[model samples]
Target: MKKNLNFLMGAVLLMATVLFASCNAEDDFLVSPVDSTGAVTRSVTTDPYVIDFANVPAAYTASDKYGANLYTGGAGQITEGYKVQLGNSGTYVQFPVNYLEQEWGEEPRPWQYDYWNGGLAVSDYTDITDGTYLNQCSVYNGGIAGVDNDKFVVAYGYSDFYNDPLSTYDKCAKIYLTDATGYTVVEEGTPVEGTVKTGTFNSVYVCNTTYSQIVMRDGNSFTTGGKSLEEQEGWFKVEFIGFASSDTSVAPTGKVTYYLANFDKSKEEESGLHGEIRTGWNQVDLTDLGTGVHMVVVNFVGSDKSDYGLNTPAYCALDNLSISL
Candidate 1:
């Protein structure tokens, strides 16, 4: 009887050891890094290049007008040396600017009135009130985490320009990578070839503009027939279309869609998404786009539509764009 009892205890110990090993293996797998869409597997090697806008020029911070820099005429001092540098690596992420017409007229035909209506602009506007309709450049959350950073880029996809038959341009903002040549010249002692100019996109932090968030949360005189987005069961989203370096003329390599606000009950039930308006910065993963992603076109769309197209404000704030280069 003593021998039998000892054998039973040894069997139990073996089972416990096997169970512990299995659990440990699963834990490691879950902790392993996976792509945002679960379509690609990647390991975090070098630190990602983060575009936090910490080095913007002092002129951009002037308080004479609004807190945002319009990047007027498509290029200026800000665009001249725009780049992101980390450790020994540096690269350029150029925001597509609408070309300004130079007719040599007085005031050059008020911007966005008779000329460009969409593009990228740098902003630090932070008024989060519902009635502050004039402050279209402000982000509702003020910044990523509302403290860590105050400057970010606002993308405006002009549905009017896109839908206009005579217009030959789409106002959707796009980001393209380039070597740090025409922009920031490498300083002395900095190896030029070490710069990785292009890589697969990892993620980007995004938030709603004060204009968009307010209009969506509370109906305005202009849209939804004075019905709030939630009352109208509306939805809004931003799309990132990734293009490979070799063949951008072809179809996009991949696309990632992130919803800024969703009150559609059908979609919520189908996709298991809780319908809510986004007021804080949310991370949108793009790892599924794979490597050599040279360009990404940002587009905004929504359920609210009129004859001119998307009735919702075509604005969104972007910060902390991560790329594995």
Candidate 2:
């Protein structure tokens, strides 16, 4: 009887140990949607090259104008550098070096006639629903098509906050985009009669249920770059592009240019994005000018421009900056 009692107690202890182990494993594997700082967090990589973008509290909306020296670099004197912003659209958007404060839910507070005049537009100017509508606007935080990065900064070509190339948020990092992973797009395969297509992204296939194009699961839509299936037939459409130059002499001067993106394109269009950003970590090479590059500025411009204003939002995303100091 004594032996049997001891056996029973041992069995109970083993079961308890298993349960405790399982619970600990689950806790370690959990991925939080919003980071502890409440700011959106992207690729949780231990890569050494990644920038030192620290998270601020959600209420921190402080922003600075451009043209000031950016990097303090632990030295009392300001180090000559620019803060690199990665457009969720895959373009490089630059802010004043002082604009380094990466905050969460930072709304577009315009400083000009049409910077972020969301209420001025017939509809919400910030509305990028149709891919075409958000011209000259600003794209803030986003969750994209695949698990590229949990969160990132987005800036369109014309997204210089004060619209001044001479000054204001004008510097961008030069990066080489080389992979498209987990990129999810939807085709309006056999569109139901009432389905309404929205954004006119190049990757989107507009047709009825009987048409042939990109394949998407029925009754459910795919999500990418911070949006779900774009149209009713194709509710959410997203297009990401990027541009760079070997010339780092100034902002927007590109005698030599480079194209980068994840997806494939038949021909080179005049738009900024070379291709869409893919899922997983991609290999980006930023050596257009070779090593010893002190710094590079992003000159984000777009085709949708006129005297009155520019088109497309000002936003971009960047991470894992590979450079030699």
Candidate 3:
């Protein structure tokens, strides 16, 4: 059964230095600090490939050619002005980048300048106050690993897109595996680039965005008939569904569901279970999805429903995503 959900500018010679420094920093982050013998400690089999947005190359985040900026609802946002180049096809990660040209420069496209559509986006916004504004795209605890961590990815899950075959909303963070360089989609029997032999779903850290946390804890003016989760006896969660290589039709190896908020009156009354509005960062293990999983589709579900789908804010912040091959 299918579960329904809704849901850089930079430099040069100093640029080369920045890119080299960024890669080295990412390596350093993945492995421990070097020792007396200049040997870094890391278990190739155990240490998964982690994607920390803070270490994204300067060229991708700052320069004019392949830059991406967070949607700040101001002059800083870049809807269609920027482009992203996937370095290689072996194994690459991508967040949705809906170009304005395709949709008449719409304001709510996946990569729009104002409101976020259902998709994945890179963000470092840290405002935790004013949950009323849909544009406040920050984790409640600020970061998954720590409060001061530089960057994380925000995901908006729309069930209508995932459930509707004709829907065009891009609603998931994708890791593509290609047979060779320059390819964007996964190919069966094609080797993934790097040392990874087979793609494995490890884990990811998830937390409620400020907009979601507040709306779940307290009623918001919009949606759910202006009722909180407590009042509506509702729940909110995201599902990570893993698919086989080159195949994405409903069938998946497995699915992992992580709840962002749950307010069941029965459970609270009978088992002494207090309502849970997720705070800080919680790790959702995906090992159950198993190895050889090339793609994972994430979507959100909530008890508050209208004809349009989930009424609760469908936003979640993710960080420290670990994948192994």
Best by TM-score: 1
Higher-ranked by lDDT: 2 or 3? 3
lDDT of each: 0.61, 0.26, 0.56
Off by over 4 Å in 2: 1-48, 52-151, 155-283
Q: Model 2, range 117-178, lDDT digits (tens) per residue?
A: 11100001122232322122212113121123222222223323344444322233222221
lDDT, model 3, position 283? 81
TM-score for all predictions?
0.67, 0.31, 0.66
Model 2: weakest 10-residue lDDT segment is 204-213
* Candidate 2 backbone overlaps, count: 48
RMSD of 1: 16.1
User: Model 3: per-residue lDDT, tens digit, 158-212?
Assistant: 6563344453224443444322232221332232122222467688888777778
Rank by TM-score, descending?
A: 1, 3, 2
Positional deviation of 17 in candidate 1, in angstroms?
64
Q: Of the candidates numbered 1 and 3, which has the greater TM-score value?
A: 1
Clashes (N, CA, C under 3 Å) per candidate: 0, 48, 18
Residues 179-221, candidate 1, lDDT per residue (tens digit)?
4442222443221122225677899888888888988888787
